[model samples]
Target: MTEQNVDLGKNPRANRIPWPPLLLIASIAAGALATWVWPLPWPGINDGPAHGVGLGFGVAGIALIVWAIITLRKRGTTFLPDGTATSLVTSGPFARFRNPIYLGDALIVLSIAEITHSIWFVAAALLFGILVTALQIVPEERHLESQFGDAYLDYKSRTRRWI
Candidate 1:
């Protein structure tokens, strides 16, 4: 695939503080609040199954997130997208996908929506993914491409953005 062509030298929004984690938190809060505002029931599934599904997805998502953090920590790299990258992580979860954390974020969003059984929550989840990808992931990728050059290009070529 062709790389995204963005002018880093003249970009005006590069100095802004990153808010990906805050966005994730807001998404979760919005979901929970939405459940309170318009709590709905699953069409055919029982409460037990719903809870089980939510718990399953939530735990797995949490685990994935933790794993990604641990990986970054073990490698002594910055998890913050806005910061400088210290290493080109390509092991563990990184070996599988370029963005395990983002995948985990999506999963967590899914789990929250599932648990709440709220259409509004699901909408928030979708918005969460879209916003993160556009605001955080895109910038991070651009930085990685610039910082790591051909190495990142090779990694990006081999790995999927979100698997």
Candidate 2:
């Protein structure tokens, strides 16, 4: 039997616990809480214009997420962390970032940092990136590699994981 035919079933890693969105939420909450309890005196621009820019970043992030979702649904693919993807999405934001949703999440975190004037949120964004990469992206990549074989490999070769 061919390698691709080994397990063309539901994603093997779908059963893993601690969903990606939950991880992101946890990271953001932790950062916000930390900032509230122990505000970091980081010296940087976090004023009216900065907050406005932060809001803009948040809008952009939300827009990216919505665009991705629309593209995925149109392609008949799943966006849920545990749901099986029906196809390898390679258009829209996927063309630029392999994990646009995660990128959006990062942008939202940055938004929080700027809006709240807290460096803790910046750290939170980084932590979220590392955690999601380890807990979600890696598994999803493996699953996609198994599901789409060379098509996915080729896409991975051309697409950036995050941008």
Candidate 3:
């Protein structure tokens, strides 16, 4: 079998273990722990306004995930870790943001930070977000560029990294 075929058969590291998803899970766990252990000073109104905002961000993040899934399904594509794209997706949320899911995740993290009113937590979230984007998304884009050529270039030119 060819190397590509071998790659397809073997469970690649990226496919088997996705760091971004894992990081996000870890961040959420840490945030929840901080909420219980560190217990930030709650706002005057305990009607859970902060919680509501955090929930809103969570909802947005979920929506973005759905958007990404829909786009991938519609295009019959997969953004595999091995830098493979069966098709290009330029519709739906992809039309607006090149990395909507990442942005949504960042927003969710930021909201959690706000809800907890922990500067340290906020900083941690921001740093984690930046690291994930740089390490994960940037490389994915490079792969996409290599795969799609000028079409990908034009798409990159038109779409913002985050919106």
Query: Highest lDDT: which candidate?
Result: 2
Give per-residue CA lDDT, model 1, range 1-163, as digits (tens).
Answer: 2233344343323215666778888888887787787776745355887788887978887888889888887887767755656567888788888888877887888877767566666777788888888888788777777766787789889999887
The CA lDDT of each predicted structure is 0.74, 0.83, 0.66
Q: Where does candidate 3 have its weakest 10-residue lDDT segment?
A: 1-10
**Cand. 3 TM to true fold:** 0.73
Locate the minimum summed-lDDT window of 10 residues in model 1. Answer: 6-15
Q: What ranking emerges by TM-score with the best candidate at the front? A: 2, 1, 3
Clashing pairs in 3: none
lDDT score for residue 69 of model 1? 82
Residue 143 in candidate 1 has what lDDT? 70
CA displacement after TM-score superposition, residue 124 of candidate 1 (Å): 1.5
lDDT at 1, model 2? 9
lDDT of 3: 0.66
**Once all C-alphas are superposed, what RMSD does model 1 give against the true structure?**
5.0
* RMSD (Å) per prediction: 5.0, 3.7, 5.8
TM-score to native of every candidate shown: 0.81, 0.89, 0.73
Error of 1 at 138 (Å): 0.7
Candidate 3, position 101, lDDT: 70
- Kindly list the per-residue Cα lDDT of model 2 for residues 101-142, writing each as its tens digit: 989999999888888788999999999999999888998898
Model 1, C-alpha of 50: deviation from truth (Å): 4.1
